[model samples]
Target chain A: MSVENFLILGLGWAGIFLPTALGAIGSIVGCARAGQAACGALLDVESGYGRLVGASALPSSQTIYGIVVTMQLNRQVSVEASPGLFALGVLVGLALLCSAVLQGSCVASAINASKSKPEVFGLAIAPAAIVEGFAVFAFIFGLIISGGIPGTLAG
Target chain B: MPTATNYYMLVASLPRMPRTFEVEQVPISRLRLQQRLEMLNEEDTTTVQQMQEFLLWDRQHPDRTDTEVLQEYEQLMQRVRNVLARKIIVYRMDVRTITCGLRRRRLGMDPPSGVGQWVQAIRENWEHPDFRLARQHPWIPLVRGYMEAHQPLQTERQLLLAIWNQWTRLADRYYFSFETILLYLARWEIVDRWTRLNESLGRQHFESLLTEALGEHARFPQ
Candidate 1:
């Protein structure tokens, strides 16, 4: 293949994979932050260890959503399609990234709050769940946007 | 991605501390706090250690002279990397200086014209109660009241609690950052100091009071 064609294909591949890459990166950071708090909460209280750990894992949902969006974006990935792929994939990935990391902070705060006031545990997690909802919005929209690109399942 | 230096785990592991003087006992035991402190990165751990050293009730260096201690503290301000730490130290200096001025005035001594940071503040506002600082620090008036009343315990509690409250505000501002951990340690030291006061020093105060009362009663003077 020509150099231009190779470059286009490479760009397309990057676009196709950006969502997963960025999402995973964000999830890794987010999970680690929340997990650290969970581990800390475990030190403070014994019985709620399971719940804290569960809450910490909430950020990981963004990564799953990113995967689904990327699967939907899978297609011929031609020069014509690469720009759209890059735009949607990167935008969705960034949204997922921010949502996951921000949710991690929220989860950490939740853990800290609930460790002291156990009654607020359920209420504390509501914010984190809301953050995940934003990521899902990006994921579903990314899938819808992917349908416009040529040779994709929707196309 | 990995929160290597962030204090989320350490802060979370520690129990929520109540207001200063609210509890006689610290929420976390020394051993447990030490274990949690081990999680701090080398640099922040050093900062915490250095700052804690300055938290001793009288803030005196037993081995070092006053000049040397001031020099050491000046060096600490330069060496500590955190802005919050520097700001806290400056705030502490102002508080300590005001307290010193209060004590010197209580003793009818002129503000010493020597190697101190706040001699100027004291000398300039020598005649003014609260040393013109009452507006900035409303507690200045209260601290002055306690000092003049010869209520050292109350004076100390007020001073320490003020410091504790300052640290609390600083911690709340930085919430999840490493600065929060630093402020947490500072506040913890205040709680520890309050609780520790009820032991040896408290007994000494009580004994002294009893002796003074007996001495007053045994006034068989010509």
Candidate 2:
């Protein structure tokens, strides 16, 4: 496959997965804070669960997006395609997929934390942002690599 | 059969009890009228004539302590209280039902407006005729008490205490209505109103009364 094909696939994956990963990370932090505060008199355990679930659930949209892009790219590539471009596309897809996984996992962790101390929700945003930043970095890198390849070597 | 003569004698004897004369002492005459009205079961021509004469006398004599007049006023006030209580119950129930319906649809979403609408509705409806009439009945008794106290110059504490006592009486009735509504309605707005009203009257009024009383005492130094 051409460098253009690899870049398109990477962009699509990033577009779908990055948001999901960021949202998941944010949810995780929020849930953790909730858990920490759960011991107090004001803590509402049921509401905490609802909030945690809401936060964690946001990342699933990105996972579905990443999967669709991966399948599309796989169909576009053939055995005769340039190995270099194919390898690049595969690496970009992996990065995007990893980000989604990280987001989902973080969200899950936050949910667990919220169950114990519901008051920690305010502090969860930072870690989620950090994870999001990494996802963005990978996305930009994939886009740049794809853009640099010549058109004739694209497919 | 408590006659009109009995009511006249009761009113005439009021000046004897200096303490009871100041405040409303249950108006036994009016209570008798209410009881008589409730007990009138026969459609006898003589009883109907007596009833008509009683109502006519009540209307013609503005200053008369006729049992029928007092009973009429009592009935009017009772109707007002009932309507206000009913409106409060309906308003609270509607809010609770609507909130529950919304919750079922959204899974656990908090209502965006919170209790703001409920508060506004309550305050607005508070001026309804029924609520107004119910609120007015106690004012007469309060004024009567204050007048009978016959203090040439009232102390600030005395005035504050009197006002606070009246307010507390009114608040008690208001709370009764509120609690009745709350028994069936779980919306935050009703709860918010109860809390806000209690705090406003109880704490805020208490502080203001104390400050005013202290200020007066400082100036007079008695």
lDDT of each: 0.81, 0.38
Candidate 1 positional error at B107, Å: 1.0
Superposed Cα deviation of residue B46, candidate 1 (Å): 1.7
Best by TM-score: 1
Instruction: Give the proportion of true interface contacts each model preserves, from 0 to 1.
Output: 0.78, 0.00
lDDT of 1 by residue, B1-222 (tens): 333675788888889888655476888887888888988777788888877766663545456555765777778777877787777777887787778778888899877443345668678989999778777777888888887898988898889878877777767776577877877777887787788886657778877887788977645568
Give candidate 2 misplaced runs (Cα > 4 Å).
A1-44, A48-50, A61-81, A152-155, B1-222
**How well does candidate 2 reproduce the true complex, by DockQ?**
0.00
Cα misplacement distance, residue B34 of candidate 1 (Å): 1.7
The true-versus-predicted C-alpha distance at residue B67 of model 1, in Å, is 2.7
User: Candidate 2 lDDT, tens digit per residue, A78-127?
Assistant: 32333434554556545555555566445444443444456775565356
